[model samples]
Target: MVENPLETETLARLYLAQGHPEKALPIFEKLLSREPDRLSIRESLARCRDEVSRAGREAAVNEKKRLRILERMLARLTGSTPPEEEIPAAPAIQPPRPGAVERRLAVLKQMLQRLERSR
Candidate 1:
């Protein structure tokens, strides 16, 4: 089957982000054949290789967690099995965290922006 370059690139990057650079590289190479001038794609492919070399799984792990959150959120809202892998290692975080300084700062920034817009 023929694969679209855009889709292949996207999936390759996604796979690399999910700690599967082995899976991603081939797709990226194939994508390169189709879009040899895309520097970002090549850069991501290189980054994927770099990620494999480093002793880090946090980015991929976080990605898994986020994918799970979306899946669970969808499942709760619409009674259907999500098409993504669900990582259930951590608790879900809300945007409006009760006591976080950063959250408060973000709200204040939004308010300040609104106030500025009105002036």
Candidate 2:
């Protein structure tokens, strides 16, 4: 029962193409460990790590923006002053994917709905 390196590489690339770099990273790491001299695998591993790092940063930024929006919405509901800083312009957001903004907006809407129901 031998695992084919080419098959493993194909699986890793599939994960990357599907936008699951986190899943792909460990596979690349394992592949690199077994064949450290493969330049192409090394490069792919580096790229996977970069994508994972970028995704984490983007998530953090989006979480902050979501919290800010929620805080303002709550303040308005409670008749308190909203935060002094305005929500940044829409163009300021640099999402990693085309559907990221839509997904965030959907989550925010659900949060707002829950808040309203609690009142």
Candidate with maximal TM-score: 2
- Residues 1-119, model 2: lDDT tens digits: 67666659889999999999998998898899889999999999999999999999999999988998999999999999998886457676664798888999999999999999999
Clash counts for the predictions, in order: 0, 0
TM-score of every candidate relative to the true structure: 0.39, 0.66
Full-model lDDT for every candidate = 0.78, 0.91
Give lDDT tens digits, candidate 1, residues 10-111. 788788778788778777777777789999988987887776666357667788778878878989789887676635588777676567888788999999
Clashes of 2: 0
Give the Å shift of residue 75 in candidate 1.
Answer: 53
